[model samples]
Target: MKRIAVLGSGTAGLHLSYALVNSGAFQVTVYTDRTPEEVKRGRVSSTQVHFGPARAREAAYGMPLWEAGPELESIHVTVGGQKLFTGGLVHPAKSVDQRAYFFRCMKDLEAKGVSFVYGRVDEERLQELARAYDLIVDCSGKRGPIAPFPQIGELSPVTTPQRKCSAGYFHGVVPLEPAGVSITILPGAGELFEIPALTALGPVTILFIESVPGGPLDVFGGIKDPESFRDRMRAVVDRHFPAVAARVDGEHFGLCDERGFVQIAVQPAVHRPYCTVGGTLVLGCGDSVVLNDPITGQGCNTASYCAEQLVRTLTEEPVGPWDERTGEAYWKRIRDYVTEVTQWSNAMMGPLPDHAVGRLMAAAADPAAADRIAGWFADPATAYEDLFRSAAGTKEQAERQGGL
Candidate 1:
């Protein structure tokens, strides 16, 4: 069996590991900085909704499943306090706290015969690993690829972060009717995303604030303690998002745990996903390669998608030295997908284009359009078409009319 070393244990690393081991074709060893206990106890890192496709991939890989959490059926949209329409998803999505999800998966994968090596893998240690393993797959998430994978300039247009993201898993927010994710866009200010999720403590609501820097919703700066974060979030909701505020139960409204909140900003970028380190081929997956703003909630879903593609690439290719050719094949299969997702995600961070806004307004009047809008989150390629391709078509039509 070929020896493969997978780094980091986020959705990408874990999912890839599970798929690889299930094939019984290679010996997979996961190198992560934290143990399962540490992961379970650590502060919440992200908010996610595993859409239909991502969930299907998980099942195919035989990854651990969660019996709890609400099955998200629709997407609720509100803009500037005005309620639009709720679009139903064809296949339901689910959000499980990554702290719990990652912890459980790591433990389960180990039991299934995947090796786990704990502690940080620094540059020296990484070089050692490159020499030791036949191939190295980096799934280090936002913190790294560790390997020098050159950034793709065309894909990475933004140099600074578009949103200051503050998210907390809370206990007192009531679920919307039909049990789905709620998105409130505050125009130039930012957005509020209310997600129903499952954690170790049972069902909790995640309120994620994507604040345009220095905007009204960017109020969590310098707030270290949970009480302060909760108070600020409550105030923000009450002031800016009254629809959600109306659902908040004041007496019990607070973070589910002290560590359930995270405050960070992401400078969206995409990399070439492959590099050579000490003559060994290194491949990047998930956030390490296709980092984008979380406004669209595609991080975990994209990671899951890439993981499965990596597995397919490896399985289809001949059993030999996994080099740049292998990397190119994997990239070829996923490039268009990664591009569509990244572009759509980046587009969402700015003001919604007039055409895109027109579509949303039209969706409010048409259920079929609304349902298609809902499906965009589940399958982002449709979103790219709606937001970009449609606009391009309109521009071409305008040019032709002018020429005539």
Candidate 2:
């Protein structure tokens, strides 16, 4: 049997481990810093609203018990004070807090006899593991740049972040009418995504504020407590989003737990995703390879997509050397989708084009147009081909901005 070492226990790592374990073609072990208990009680990771395709991948891997809330059927996009459109999705999406999702996945994988090693892996340890396994896959996410997977310079044109994000899960906000993601795009400032989510505390609203640095929404820099964070978020909503602000009950609004809120800035990035260490080629997956700005809600979904692709490539290949040729082939399997997602995600962070806004206007007038637009959330590759690609004049405009 081929031996594999999977590092990190995030979405990609866990899903890949589950698939390999179920295949019985490889002996797989996972390395992660946190135990299932630790993960359940840890600080919040980012909000994940997994769409239909991602959920299908989970079910295929036989690890499909991830609990989720209402079907997020529409996307309500508001520009400034005007409601641009309330778009509908063909495949329903669901939001699950990462802490709950990871913990459940880890426990399920453990019951299936996958080995779990608890500790952080530095360069020396990674080199050691390289010699012990036929393949090593890193899904370490923000806690890693674990391998020397060089940044794909063309794909990663920006070295600094475009937004400072202040996001949290809370219980006091009123839910949207159709129960979907409420996207408020504040042009020249940033965007706000309000999602109805299933969390450890049951269904709650996730408010993710993507703020342009030094702009009106960049207000959560030094926030510490739940009350303070709530106050600041409420104030921002009051000033910039009157409709949403009116929904917040000032006295009751707060984070779901002490660990529910987070403040951070994410600089979008991409890497070549494979590198040699101790004569063994190590592969990268998920955020470690193609980290994007969270404006489009593609991170977890992309991770799921990549994990399934890698599993397909490995399962189809003849048993042989896990070398450069094998690595290149696997990269080819996921390269196009990865590029499409990176392109569309990066384009979203910049100013919205006139034509893109025009589509939103048209969608507001017609549900058929709205549903077509919403399909992009279910399958982002379509966004590159039609939505972002044609609507925004993305190909030429992206070139001007030095995008890949």
**Candidates' C-alpha lDDT:** 0.92, 0.86
- Measured by TM-score, how close is model 1 to the native structure? 0.98
Q: After superposition, which runs of candidate 1 have C-alpha atoms over 4 Å from their true positions?
A: none
How far does residue 218 in candidate 2 sit from its true spot (Å)?
0.7
Clashing pairs in 1: none
Writing each residue's lDDT as its tens digit, candidate 1 over 26-132 gives 99999999999999999999998999999998998888886667999999998888888999999999999999888889999989999999998878888999889
Quick one: how many clashes does candidate 1 have?
A: 0
Best by TM-score: 1
Candidate 2 per-residue lDDT, tens place, 312-380, comes to: 778888877877777888899999999999988888888866776777788888988787778778888
